[model samples]
Target: MARIPGRNPWLAWPAGIVCAAVVATLAWLALPMVPVVVAWVGESLRTATSPPVAAPVEPSRAPLLEIAESDDAIDCRRLYPDDLWVELAWRPEALLSQDFSAPSTSVASLTDALAPQVRVTCRWRFDGGGGISSTLARVASDSAAVVEAALQGEGFSCETAGAVLRCRRAQGGAVEEHAVSGDLWLSSVETGRVPEDYGARLAEGLWGAG
Candidate 1:
């Protein structure tokens, strides 16, 4: 028989297998990379178009006091000269009543009422009579209105210069006063002198009782 060129079958088989394996490996690696590239592009678009988030708001540190309609009255006490203590009761009716006595009369009445039992004496000093009168007038004209408005708006009322009491309605039928002072002008709701908080506490007690 005549000699004839023969095919290199060994070489051809190895080369075909190698090409298929390389293609399969590249596809496995590229499949995961495709989604990652798409996600990066989407995030870049969102960052460019979307608005920034707002900052968080801070809360207030001051205390909150609330009074309800059912509250009716409160009683507050204060220390006086000669180791005496004065107690004053404040009622809504008393505050709003036309028949309630003036500060001078209230002072005398309170002193009389509390004297024997508490063994304490009280005297009213109308030293700055005109000042007191003017202060009372200003307070009377604006006090209730101011208080109501403030309570409605801020849930509490405060008079820094005239009085330091913070007024709020208690859970009961009373209003309350806290941190009271004497330098301010307040009509005596009850007899004797009281600290500013007296009014606030009286309000709270009265409201609680009511």
Candidate 2:
């Protein structure tokens, strides 16, 4: 009987060697592009997840000023200089009752200090409840800012004239004016007869014409 033909184990070795060589060649050829592929993938992920840049915002504007560090000693005589009394149309010395008072504290008080104090307060009355009350107060730079902000919040129209900040408001028969210059805060309230250019004259008296 003829012996059955046997398969050759040696023939399988060449196929295996050829397959391994092909795999090694493919791996070597792709090695140079590995870093570039990895970098591209990482960049894509970063761009997708990164937050958008915010728009630039403009800063708010405030009045330019320099406040006094020391307390200002103000009196009615100094605040209402010569000719101002007549300009206000208040009677000379006959019928008007006048009052002037200054702060008792020796130290200067800020406009927004915890224990705020006024430099001086004055009142002139021609008849019962027909008069003007005024005050001069000291302030620091920061406190002056607070004062201006407060006046604006109270619906007072404000404007800057030179280095002074002036604000005014009127309701019924009462008119109010507030002015700031250097380290001084001057305020006046009038009831009954309102004078023409009263606030302007008062500020001019305190700050001396703009």
Candidate 3:
């Protein structure tokens, strides 16, 4: 055959085969890291796309003694003595609801049948225990005798102590009823097991605070 070309076509076949082998080796070496690369890309995308979360908030409640003041319901703290170590226990709205129905004979009859149309009523307890509860009710000055008789019929020894009506027994229970304002009565009861004349001091404190 004549020398048609400087290099034969068969010589070029070896070079082509070697180039194919190198490409195949590189692809086989990189196959194991494919999962790692995919995982890194997924985590980066998640971190960039996710939003930040916020914390929760708390609610506020109005103080029991600082509610709106009116003729019927004055501020409990304003009516409470400052020097006394007693605290406002409950709100008048919770305890002394008014009832126009007939009254009950028993003082403990706080149910609807016995409940009075009290305007403002709140409980205050001493630091150690025994305390007094004060209530404001509507009673005319001319009807003082009627109030006295009612309390006496219930076993309370009521007597006119100056401008106020003092009622109690030697065993411990006591009460103070005074006309704080025209046709407005303030009554305080010192529950059983308190010191002697505690009701008087409480009454004086109420007087000063009011």
Candidate 4:
């Protein structure tokens, strides 16, 4: 038989040493990047799980009038406070004041167009002769413009009192007043022996003294 070559255990040592050096070099290169890789993954997960923020909304304006919507007529007593009625020297018994008919004013056509649900008509008469007819009507913006134009055309003295547009015209003892505030319309016709500040008083009745 041919002599078997002696096993070279020393030759395997160099190969094992080369493999160990390769693994050590790789670990040295990769160790510095470990924290950076962990931080990147954590940031991505946090962003994905976070909730979004919303924008704020604005509030609407408050209404000037406090009257409710109704088809039925509002009682005259409930329109103004008791102290005001007393100050005006108006009798509670003559709330309707049927002795004389409601005055015929230029705004009759405009009043006709208003629905009862949005309109409040009040008449108060004295036992002597003269009385007042006041109408508070909530109208559309377009209708309000028409009413304002009509008053200006009728040669009424117009002025701005805060948010209220007041117009007045007087012929003999009859004094007619018209006021517009936003979508609200007020028309008062006073015939014979009526207060000079009747329109102002009515405004106070609708809003406050202010």
Candidate 5:
């Protein structure tokens, strides 16, 4: 094979390929890194020049006057003495009240939901400041059936007249049970000393008051 007059074929071809490869490598390293270098330099300048940031503030909460009571029973401790106390005396002014200034007062409070309704079981002397202990119970309600059953079962002769459960113990004393609504029972239990027909008056106030 004869060579052409001004042509060095192998040298020319290889020189061109080397130049292309070098250009490609430089482009690969420089072009993609340009934006990244510029961003880093700008961020560094901004960080060095910018002011310090302040911390965020938190919101304040409102103050409470009293703690809330649980929804269970009507806790007497949480309530005022008067709120829990209600008239339980018989026709207070009839005979007892006429004789005594304050009368052997009858007051009642309710209990927890487990033992629902009002329960009145005590003989308190209001004048002597010796009243029954606070019993957190529901309001008393008079149900003839409930009253009759409870009294009869306890060996007492009982009858439900109107909204009252009247029970006479074998020995003496009157047990007058009254109610406002539901099955709540407020009983005016007396061993003795308490005059007869007094419970009827005491029970009158409680009956249907709910």
Candidate 6:
């Protein structure tokens, strides 16, 4: 028989089948990888073209007002306009008196009565409208005594309102009231640590003088 120039039928068919299956699997696996590669390239381009974001700036706060210290109290006179003035004092201890009738002498007489017992004293003065008023408090003393003392300082008549004492002063067109409680000496009107309304009332009472 002549030598057969024949192909190996078994090898040819199996090799072809094997190659086709491998090609199909490779295409299936590469399908998902295509989108990932495209997305990565897009992100890189975006990063190369875009500018960096800037940091935000913050605002600064206002400075606090300064106060001057004296032997008797903290002074805030300079912070306000020349027409307005205020002073405050704090003491560790003082003697207080019972609310009593206004003395026959000057308001200073009331202080003279309590001076024997007061250990510490605090005082504040307010001047405005060409008129000046003062408030004084003696701590660690009886609240009544403090009220009486404040009344005496202001040249006001004294009266008891519940546990507190009130004193009034009348001069020119103004009537001023000093309401004392323990170590607190508040004007009838509020101002500063006190209320503006109270201060107004105080000024009205003092100015009205009626």
Model 1 Cα lDDT, one tens digit per residue, 1-210? 553468577877899999999999999989979989999999999999999988898843222112111133212222121122222122111221122233332124322422211111122332222111100211222244444344445444444433244444332333333222222223322222234454433323322211
- The CA root-mean-square deviation of candidate 1, after full C-alpha superposition on the true structure, stands at 16.0
Candidate 1 segments exceeding 4 Å error:
1-24, 63-210
Candidate 4 Cα errors over 4 Å, as ranges: 1-64, 68-73, 89-104, 112-118
Per-candidate TM equals 0.25, 0.53, 0.41, 0.55, 0.32, 0.29
Clashing pairs in 2: none
Quote the lDDT for 160 in model 4. 71
Q: Which stretches of candidate 5 lie over 4 Å from their true place?
A: 1-114, 117-123, 126-146, 170-181, 208-210
Q: Candidate 4 lDDT, tens digit per residue, 1-210?
A: 564498566877898899999999999999999999999999999989988667786743322245522344555555655565664565433446322233246756555654322355677777667777876666664455666677777778877776677788997788898776666667778887655477876675665432
Which should have the higher TM-score, number 2 or number 4? 4
Cα miss at 201, model 4 (Å)? 1.7
| Pairwise lDDT winner, candidates 4 and 6 | 4
Model with the higher TM-score, candidate 2 or 6: 2
Quote the positional error of residue 201 for candidate 1 in Å: 19
On the 0 to 100 scale, the lDDT of residue 27 in model 3 is: 91
Q: Native-vs-model 5 lDDT?
A: 0.41
Could you give candidate 6's per-residue lDDT for residues 32-98 as a string of tens digits?
9999999999999999999987888774321211111113432223222222332222211211222
**lDDT, residue 117, candidate 4:** 28
Question: Best TM-score goes to which candidate?
Answer: 4
Q: List the global CA lDDT of all models.
A: 0.35, 0.64, 0.51, 0.65, 0.41, 0.44
Prediction RMSDs, each to the true structure: 16.0, 15.5, 18.8, 12.0, 19.2, 15.9
Clashes of each: 37, 0, 0, 0, 15, 21
> Which 10 consecutive residues of model 3 have the lowest summed lDDT?
61-70
Error of 3 at 102 (Å): 13
Q: lDDT by residue for model 3 over 112-162, one digit each (tens)?
A: 322344655656455445555666555554455655666676676766654
**Candidate 1, lDDT over the whole model:** 0.35
Name the TM-score of candidate 5: 0.32
lDDT score of model 2? 0.64
